[model samples]
Target: MTVILLAGGLGSRMYPLTRIVPKPMVPLAGKPILEHIVDYLNTRGFKEIVIAARYLGEQIVRYFSNHPHAKPVLLDSKDTADAVRLLGNYIRDHFIVAMGDVICNADYSEIYGYHLSANPAATIALKQVENPLPYGVVYLDENMDVALFVEKPVSLEAYLLSLAYYRRRSTSAYENLVNAGIYVFNPYVLEVLERNPGLMDFGRHVFPYLVENGFKVKGYVLSHRVYWSDIGRIDTYKSVMWDLLDGKIAGIKPPATEVSPGVYIHPSSDVRGEIRPPVYIGREVRVKEGAVVGPYAVLEDGVVVEEGSRMVESIVWHGTIVGRDSVIYDSIVMNNVKISRETRVYSSIIGTRRIVSGELRNSIMEPVEVVSPYAQSA
Candidate 1:
């Protein structure tokens, strides 16, 4: 079956990082998030894949140019439904749709089988979250049919009112099942799209329309053990990285060799410093003497950590250099950045290809030619 991977959003939430590359292009483990998704889909036996991308989409095109089955389609639309509507010709029959930013190890084969068995107009994959306010909350009946859908309840009163409506009908309301941003739809859904020309989003528009118009919409609730995260923000991105290192995610593994219990280092890497567990040192990395790296650190390919430096709970992308005596705590230093001597980075995100020469705390350093605003004496 053909799967449409929607990846066209501008990703304004990720800011400078998304400015450099699309959200799907964001590196995770040792490859882009999109690559992981594609590889997983390939393993699941998906033959044809179309990637809908814009806003630095050429990078995605270039990356997948030689691929046999996966192809990139550049579109100018900003909305999810619109992207699919533009590719309506590609939808020959029943198809699967997934968001590009989400990282999920869901069983697509099982979801497809469930969809075919239920015979609904559309089937939505749902996952329970502790806090449903940030996501599109879904209310399902006893038969696993969607009763109501609310896209990111704006206020507590609104959420409570929706919960109340669900509580009156079924006790399932207690389970906070939110939209997982993956769906299987029948071909007639294309007719619905054509009927509503202005429909732009699936959560805010399409799903609700399908439920209210008496079309059968099924809900496939994932098990509690399943892992799913839309890495839309900085903290979630960092947390997902930690989860990958901890082996919390199934069907995905770090692209490195395990030297010790939880320490993964590439064969070409040179390490003279001390390394704690749960760390990943990538290709050609160099950790100079007296440096301490670990306990949730991912130093990507070609990264150099100088002597006396310490990095904890941080991710330094490919080709970045950490100067001597520097400290990186709970931060993400993007690709090719240069951290000067004795610098301190705490809970911040340093953008790509920049020179950091100061102390940054709880801030986001944009990708600009000028040095960081917090520059100070080492």
Candidate 2:
């Protein structure tokens, strides 16, 4: 079966970072998040992958130009459902549609099998989360069919209604199962889309239409052990990074080699400083003498940590230079950044190609100008 990876959202929540790179292109461990998703799908025996991209999609196209299986399809549609409608030519059979920004260790084969047996028009993947207000809350019937789908019940009345329904069903309030953004659809669903041209988003329009119109839409709940996250916000992005490093996420490996227990360092890196465990140092990374890295740190390829600097619980992306005596804790420094000496970056995000000096805490620093190769070519 073919898989359609949606990578076209504006990603407004991720702001400056998304300005240079799309949400799906954001690096986690060493590869792009989309790459990891593709790898995961490949491992699950799904070789036919189509990435539907827009909003700086050329980068995605260029990235996957040499890839054997994953292909990028640039679309002009403004919404998720529209993107799928535009790609209707590619849907010849039952297909899987997944959000590009979501990463999970979900069993796609199992979901496919369930969909086949249930034989619903669509099977929406569901997962229980602590907070359901930020996602599409799904209420399943006794037969596992979707009874009601509420996309972000932020209103008080909506919350009360959901609470009442859960109470009637004897389900715990905290046990809120949300739409995991993975769907299996029958080809007939495209006919429904053709009839409703204005149906833009699956969450906002498509699923609700099906449920209200008496179409069979089932919910497949993921197992508790399955790890999944949508890297849409800064906090979730950081949390996912930490989870991947801590080995909570399975079936994906860090790009570097584990030199010691919990310490992964690439062979090309030149390390002369003190490195605590639970850290990853990538290719061509240089950790100078007297610097203390880790306890939870990720230095991507070509990064340089100068002498006397301390980086703990931080991620420094490609080609960034941490100046002498600087302290970076709980921060994300994007690619090619240069931090001056004696700088303190705590709980902050430094965007690409920036030059930083002084104390930056609880802030977001974006570059005055972005000189990207994509921009140049465009």
Scored by TM-score, the top model is 2
lDDT of 1 by residue, 169-283 (tens): 6645437888998999998899899889888899999998889889999999988888999989877888888888888889877888887877889999999999997898988
Give candidate 1 regions above 4 Å deviation.
Answer: 171-174, 369-378
Off by over 4 Å in 2: 153-157, 165-175, 371-378
What is the Å distance of residue 336 in model 2 from its true position? 1.2
* Lowest-sum lDDT 10-residue window in model 2: 369-378
The residue pairs found clashing in candidate 1 are: none
**Candidate with best lDDT:** 2
Overall local distance difference test of candidate 2: 0.87
Score candidate 1 by TM-score against the native. Answer: 0.93
Each prediction's RMSD to truth: 4.3, 2.4
